[model samples]
Target chain A: MTTPVLEARQLIKRFGGLVATDNLSMTVNPGELHAVIGPNGAGKTTLIGQLTGAIRPDGGDIFLHGRRITHMPTFRRSRLGLARSFQITSVFSEMTVLENVALAVQAHSGHSFRFWKPALRDPALREAAEQALDFIGLAPRRDEQVGNLSHGEQRQLEMAMALATKPRILLLDEPMAGMSQEETARMVAILGPLKKSVPILLIEHDMDAVFALADRISVLVYGRIIASGSPDAIRINPEVKAAYLGDDDA
Target chain B: MSMNRATAANMVLIALLLALPPLAGLMDGEFYIILVSRALILAIAAVSLNFILGFGGMVSFGQAAFIGIGAYVVGAGTMHAFEDGIEWLGNGYTQLALTVLFSAVAATVIGAISLRTKGVYFIMITLAFGQMLYFVAVGLEIYGGDDGLSLYQRSEMPGLPDLSDDRVLYYFSLGVLLLFLYLSHRVLHSRFGKVLTGCRLNEQRMAALGFPTYRYRLVAFVIAGVMTGIAGFLLANQTDFISPAMMHWTRSGDLIIMIVLGGIGTVFGPVYGALAFLLLEEFLSGIPVTIAGYRIGEYWQLIFGPVLILIILYARGGIYGFLQPRSNGK
Candidate 1:
């Protein structure tokens, strides 16, 4: 079997008395969108944090393309094509949308130690940023200051920034958190074509979007994966239905 | 359009600064030339602080210590020249080179430790480092300890214009200031500046996007330190003396004030800020007014405090903000 693009092996993270991420393992393939859905405090964000190198696991390891990277710094992990969006929209607000994405492109283009040449004039970085923005449908608003963008647009800008890094896999944390119905639909459309090139690990509460996009689904409860299978299989699985869908139905 | 206003204002400022020495000669006297030169030197220091403080969001409160280090290098180097016949130490060119080298080295050592912390802890740690240097300066007995040391002769470069002439010194300092200002402007717009500003705005995001912000911030801190060190070198030349008092924590606080007053983040804000601050200090100190039957000449600080408070309260964008068009003022 081909190696999974990302794999977590027995990850454990404890927060004093409560284990935030219990002994858990998961894998994302190169061309699959794996969705992880759970109720609040289910440790989905913690898992994402661990995957992105923001949070270190107390035990076990994470591998990217079959290489162990459990102890790499966040920036190094990013350079290795592991990119994640913040749960909250986090773009350089004082900068223009193009500038924000350009900075992301600049990160992977080369070392940022070049101090004399103006970055806005860099054709390669600008082209890459523009492509990302165009892909995310934010090309029209490219010149606007990110601070002036709407919340949903800001989230799109965040995706543009992540994409500009040329990630091998995208870890999206609540991309539709504050998005309106139309915005969510737009985001779904924007993300539809991306999975063919770069796999995504989506942690979302919007089950409809998750169900529509995910090739496979994992149900996490109290920091542990209770079930992992095709969305249809998990939808009908007794354990998942009883533990999670039962609550959603009511 | 607003950018044009800012550019035009900057040009006018540069023009005024260029015209100052002759204007001083025509108006006030040699003292005015010295005072304006002092302002230019302090402006250089303030501009350096703005790089980290405004752009990088690193509230370093120890910048004066680097300046102090530069001044002391000159002081100690001069003393060593006279005592041990260290020929290179007496040369102005060599002294400047030594000051830049030593200051960069000091910044590297100091920044490596201080950049480890963030926010208030970062501010406090930098302050602590500044105070540490202050004490070290005070303890140097050979450099006159508390009494400070005076330079009998300013360092001189052969075949170049003498630095001893007040006009020559003023123009030389102005030239250095412009060069640094240009260099800083380039840096602020470069890829390095974007990353630094990105780190300032969202460090976590910058890291997530593959920027090693700590190293960028450390380099920026050192750059600011070296630039301020240049200011310190000029200060030693301007004053012809060196003392531990130059590195006092309050002096660092004053540098912060200059940055804030001018407009913390803007490129030339510190220049405007330094000019306003020094001019106000001169103007206030010269006036003797009776308020409630008490002389307020030496008590100018009492009035200055309230004015600063008023500016902070109403004009959040600062004096430079007030000058720019409202849309892009910030």
Candidate 2:
């Protein structure tokens, strides 16, 4: 059996009196789209943070390809083929689209101590950035300043940046958040093919997209998963319906 | 192809600077050489300050302390050479090497601590360090304490052009500035420069991108310190004096003003800033008019103050920004 691309075993996180993540365990196998659906403040983001090494879990170990990385720093985790897109559209707005992606490519490629030659002129970096931008359908806007891009475009750029790192797994934190319906559809379209190439652990609120795209769905409520199964099983699970899917939405 | 306005302006500026020494010679204005040399030296310091402030997003309010550190290296070297007969310490090359070494150490210590904090806290901490250095200089009785030390001669570079000649000194200062400008251009466009710029714009994003940003910033800080220390070496040689006053917070403020007035992140901005600042000071302070029995020139800052505000308000990117064509607005 192939090892899971990512595995979080009994992760726990607490904030003062509140338990943000409680005994959360999940896995994304190779070539799988695992969608995590939860209500607001169900610790979805906190889970992503712990996986990315931005936050330390109170109890549990995270493994990437069977190698423990629970205590790795954020950057080291990224270098070890873990990439994440923020819940909010976090990007280097002052730079150009290509420049933003190039930086991500630069990060994974090698050390950035090249102090004489112009970074943008490097063919390897430029080509990789272009490919990532093209994959996200943002190649035409490559030279435009990020601040000038539309909100949806910036969200797409975030995906492109994560993609440029050539990660073994992608952690998407509400990639569709704040996107308009058209933009959401565009993002889903981008994700549909992307999941075939890299395993993705997606935290999202849009049910239709999740149901359509997710191979397996995990329904989280109050910082713990109530159900985890194939899309059909999750849709029919009685506990998921009562706790999260609500009869009307289900 | 037509050159852009900023490139054209930069070219013109370089040409004028190159021609200044010869032109001053033609006009027999030896005094102008000294004035312009002093301006160029300060411009070097301002450029180093901008390296961290503009490119790295480190607002170091105590940059003058590096300059003081550098100049004192020169002063201390000369003193030990002449008074104590520690001859090698007086060597210009040795002083330059020591200046680089000492300032790198200072920047590492200061940056390691300051970089942990952001915004106003960073500013305050740097200011505190600068003040500490200033007071330390004041308490050094062997170095003349608060009164300052007088060097008997300019640093003796055995194999190079003599720095004693004002014209030679002007050319030397200009050469150093050009070298730094070239280095700045190379470094800013390089991969390391991109990372540094990224840190300035969005440090969090940079960290997530697999960059250990604190290490990058600390390295930039050290490089900037070394550059400023070199400027201090020249400044001491130029004036033949060093004092605790060089490290005062106000001098550090002047460096920031020069960066802002010229262009914050632009390579040639600080040079323009230093020239504008010194020339304005000379011109405004020379106004012979008396306002109610007080010389107007003595209070030149009153007029200068309003002008700086107007520039900061109206000039979005300082003078260099104005030089660029509108389409390239940051």
* A1-250: candidate 1 lDDT, tens digit per residue: 8999999999999999999899999999988999999889999999999999999999999999999999999999999999999998888878899999999999999899999999999899889999998888999999887778999999999898899999999999999999999999998987778898999999998888898899999999999999999988988899998878785641
**For candidate 1, lDDT tens digit of each residue in B1-330?**
345766788899999889988888888688988998999999999999999998899999999998998899888888888988887788887888887888899889888998888899999999999999999999999999988999867777788788888788889889988898888889989999999899899999999999999899999998999899989988988899999999999999999999889888888888989989999999887787877987787888987898889987887767887777545424
lDDT of the candidates, in the order given:
0.90, 0.91
lDDT at residue B235 of model 1 (Cα atoms): 90
The clash count for each model shown is: 0, 0
TM-score of 2: 0.95
Identify the candidate with maximal lDDT: 2
TM per model? 0.97, 0.95
Q: Which stretches of candidate 1 lie above 4 Å from their native place? A: A247-250, B1-3, B291-294, B326-330
- Predicted complex 2: DockQ: 0.74
DockQ, structure candidate 1: 0.85
Worst 10 residues of 2 chain B by lDDT: B321-330
True contacts kept of each: 0.92, 0.77
